[model samples]
Target: MSALILVVDDEPDVAELFRQQFRKELRASRFDMEFAQSAPEALERVGAAEAARLILILSDVNMPGMSGIELLPRARKARPDVPVIMITAYRDSETRPKAIEAGAAGLFTKPIDFPELRGEIGRRLDAATGPQ
Candidate 1:
């Protein structure tokens, strides 16, 4: 089955950028894309999906209600095998450690390099679900 990635960000433009990049890659492969504007929205999506179909979650660390770190634990609990990658504008010792402690698979700074992030996502997805 194709991997499904959820790009979670508060900003519409940020989510659209991720959608475009991943969609371009998936067009040539077996994969799918989805988006949520907030952590709650992401959780709701997972709940509504009714299974662990979500393979990857790419979320912005800074959000209005709950930061990605705050949501990571819940996301992990909701879908233990699905990996969460935290994206943030601020990178520091504290934030990184907190994200890790909360169960983030990895963390990246904002103004992200989509090509490289896509590669990393591919690697993680491979590791989680196995080849293809």
Candidate 2:
């Protein structure tokens, strides 16, 4: 069975972009991706039984109701074993520190480097599952 990755972003287009970028992996069944357009939806998904397959979370920092940084600690509380990586278009001085302090596993700036992100995901999944 493939591991699950949850992606949370306010923008509607972000989901399509992730699907396109991770198309090969998705086709190969290396992992499955799920999208949550808001932090509340993400939290629901995280707390659900479906989260049993969850290994990672990719969340945008600037959502309307709850920013990714704000969601970080709550998500961790819900599923401490899963790692959360924050993504932001802003990437200001305060963002990084706030994310880290809130328990983010990593942070990525927007117009994300997909290859690097993929590598990081691979590493985390590898570490989680151990040797194939």
Candidate 3:
């Protein structure tokens, strides 16, 4: 089964960007990406039955209602095994620590480095699958 990744960002264009960046993986059926425009929407996805396939969550730090940091614990509470990576335009010291404290597995600065992000995702997925 393809590993599911939920991406939460208020910007509508972010979904297309992720699709472009991970096109090869998607074509290869390695990852299945889903988008949520808001934190509440993401939470609903997390609680849904399909969440069993969810392996990772990528979320923007700033949003209309709930920030990604605020969503971390709630998401974790729903699925403790899923790792969350925060994406933000602001890579300030405060932001990183706060995200970590709130239970984010990692943080990616805006103008995301897709190669680095890809490597991290591969590593995490490998760790999750274990000796496949």
Output the number of the lDDT-best candidate.
2
Residue 15 error for model 1, in Å?
Answer: 2.1
**Residue 108, candidate 3: how far off, in angstroms?**
0.6
Question: Model 3 off-target regions past 4 Å?
Answer: 49-51
Residue 53 in model 1: lDDT: 59
Give the alpha carbon lDDT tens digit for every residue of 1-132 in model 3. 777899999999999999999999899988799999999999999998365578899999999889888899999999998999999999578999998999999999989999999998898778766533
Clashes of each: 0, 0, 0
**In model 2, which range of ten residues has the least summed lDDT?**
45-54
Please write out the lDDT profile of model 1 over residues 35-114, one tens digit for every residue. 88888998998777535457888888998998777888889998887888999898677888888888998888877987
For each candidate, the alpha-carbon lDDT, in order, equals 0.81, 0.91, 0.90
Model 2 pairs in collision: none
Which prediction has more favorable lDDT, 1 or 2? 2
Between candidates 1 and 2, the one scoring higher on TM-score is: 2
Candidate 2 Cα outliers beyond 4 Å, as residue runs: 49-52
Scored against the true structure, residue 73 in model 3 reaches a CA lDDT of 96
- Each prediction's TM-score versus the true structure: 0.88, 0.95, 0.94
Model 1 misplacement above 4 A: 50-52
The sequence of per-residue lDDT tens digits that candidate 2 reaches over residues 37-107 is: 99999999898836558999999999998888889999999999999999999958999998899999999
